[model samples]
Target: MRDTVIYAHRGLNHAAPENTLAAFAAASRSGVTWIETDTDILADGTAVIMHDSRTDRTTNRSGSIYDLTTSDLDTIDAGSWFSGDFVGERVPTLRELVSFLGPHDLNLNLELKGNTQGRDRSIRLVETVLEELRRLRPGTRVLISSFSPLLLAEVHRRTDAYELAWLVDKGTIGEDWRSVMELCGATALHPSTAVVSNRCVVEEIRRAGFGVNVWTVNSVQEANKLVNWGCTGIITDIADQMVEAGRRR
Candidate 1:
């Protein structure tokens, strides 16, 4: 009800390939001004939009994202897996996504993927993402979330230019939600829908002075329930439905 924003989770993946430009465009067309996407670095230290460490699930290529350079990533077909309608779509760099969303006044929820390679690589991921945000879209509202405390801490250490949110599961928030938030210097919490579907927990998180944005909420009933409960944001795969649900409140 009260300005509960609907963020398109992975850019409405039900309609297009996840994390691709095609998916982002589809979400925008569906009247979504907020989109959530994953960010991982390539071998060349280029920040790119991708959900998985490997390309097998989303693209025609076969290799770990960290092993591939930006050129290697661009050569693969990223859209065909979802449908032929998105045939020629290539993987987009974070810079590309930022440039695309900046002028449109669209907000982004960029999830930072952990560097499976090592600690140095993880620090680099944080640096690369922050540098992109500072350079490409300085004035834009971007919320950065991650389950990795190391990564979030790295981000917090480098810059506080953007809002940071700690992503947590049911067990992770048991009695230490505030502690976790303080540890990462995060002002927000991105809890799994399975964990936060309980209205009491949502109230608890809000009472702790942390904004709650639940993830992957797709159904209108669920969306309405959360919005009515005064959740700050709902990350959904069905942005249109959730937007309508928010309006109904």
Candidate 2:
């Protein structure tokens, strides 16, 4: 049996609020080694851990993440929406996340959220994230990923310290994925489950020498299939379940 790595999507988001320390803790307790989360820049240049550009869905506040500062986030409850047990969870900064995971043996797959503010803002976000990583230099392995080719390219240009991955949805994946990956200096491809349904597609990508890591997978059967197809990583919300399934296989 292949040893496919299981990455807890948003830190075992199914068990706790997505992107919260609680979820990450839960994942750690479940024996997960890889965590996949999103990071975005705030108004005051702080890089925060979140999956959306807006705080409406995940927090008590309703505003763009770009318009909010660290102080503003202090008043926001990032966990209440998911469950009362996590009521006081605040949105964590990238630095905080790095510190939090420092003692653990977990690897991070940090997805850079696309900025709608413009190219300059995007560059700032990239630089801010890279700077944070450089400053802390956490013990855990880090892989920076983004759906934006421009963002990935910028990351590639600024630093070669961390690995880069290009994210693509099913319909957006084109025949030129290889060329784009090369241009962005990405060492891996994170594609949606839909894109990897065709076995040959997974084989082709692995043949090209880029690691294949599929995202948001929840089904054990599906994960088994992907692993059999030579997928290097499985990003899933149900980490404990997936880990057990892998053991059984």
Top model number, lDDT: 2
lDDT of each: 0.84, 0.89
**Full-model lDDT, candidate 2:** 0.89
Query: Candidate 2 — which residues are off by over 4 angstroms?
Result: none
Worst 10 residues of 1 by lDDT: 131-140
TM-score of each: 0.94, 0.96
lDDT of 1 at 170: 75
Looking at model 2, residue 58 earns an lDDT score of 93
Per-residue lDDT of 22-120 in model 2, one digit per residue for the tens? 899899999898899999899888999999999999999898898988888779999999998999898999988888786766788999998888888
Model 2 weakest 10-residue run by lDDT: 131-140
Candidate 1, superposed: residue stretches over 4 Å from native: none
Error of 2 at 17 (Å): 0.5
TM-score attained by model 2: 0.96
Please provide, for model 1 over 1-249, each residue's C-alpha lDDT reduced to its tens digit, 9 standing for 90 to 100.
438878999997889998888788888887788899999898889999999999999999987988898778658999888899988789999989988887666789999997788988888888888778875555668889998866787788878887899988877766766886888889999988878867898898888898988887878788778877768988888887777665666
